[model samples]
Target: MEDLWQAFVNVDSAGNITGDYSGKNIVAEDPYDFFFLVDKEVALSLHEYKVHLDGFKPSLVPKQSAE
Candidate 1:
């Protein structure tokens, strides 16, 4: 038998972690990967995750305009 571990991450602007994953020193450059890690670590059901995610909204990067 194997024991599975999970971790929830919350990052803010400037690539700084600011939530459950804070102080872990894990830096991420891609928002998709970052959120994916968070979602995976949560280990929650789809409905539960949707409710949780909706309640805890994270900051998103602003889109850059083409010159």
Candidate 2:
């Protein structure tokens, strides 16, 4: 056993764990073996996603008839 590191794991495709894996402090040859790193800023908010708005209105309003 050595200094433990924390990371996120992709359960759908996980590798062999050091122990029974009680849901905490899992050991493995490499973090990439099971756990994966996720960029919160990128995944939560994509940088490539951008749109410019120019006050465009496409709604039609019915005009009231003068009495």
Candidate 3:
């Protein structure tokens, strides 16, 4: 199995990214994917979002006991 992290562009009335771009990165998994979209007026801009995953949130199994 593969692990993954995810994020989405949070938009406001104007459709701009609601939060700062402090943590966002572009992924090359799929080029033609619609990662972002904005309406006219130029008031809104899509943001590339990303996340990091060191490992599963919690191990499925507990630490093995000494054999």
lDDT of each: 0.33, 0.28, 0.27
Rate residue 20 of model 3 by lDDT: 26
Model 2 ranges off by over 4 Å: 1-7, 10-33, 41-67
Q: TM-score of predicted model 2? A: 0.16
Can you rank all candidates by lDDT, best first? Answer: 1, 2, 3
Q: What TM-score would each prediction reach against the true structure?
A: 0.24, 0.16, 0.21
Backbone collision count in every prediction?
A: 0, 0, 0
Q: Write the per-residue lDDT of candidate 3 for residues 3-54, one digit (tens) a residue.
A: 2222333344333344422113435343321232222211122233222223
RMSD of each: 11.9, 20.7, 16.8
Best of the candidates, lDDT: 1
Which scores higher on TM-score, 2 or 3? 3
Candidate 3's displacement at residue 13, Å, is 0.4
Model 3: lowest-lDDT 10 consecutive positions = 58-67
Give the residue spans of candidate 1 off by over 4 A: 1-4, 21-67
Q: Which candidate comes out best when scored by TM-score?
A: 1
Alpha-carbon deviation at 13 in model 1, angstroms: 1.2
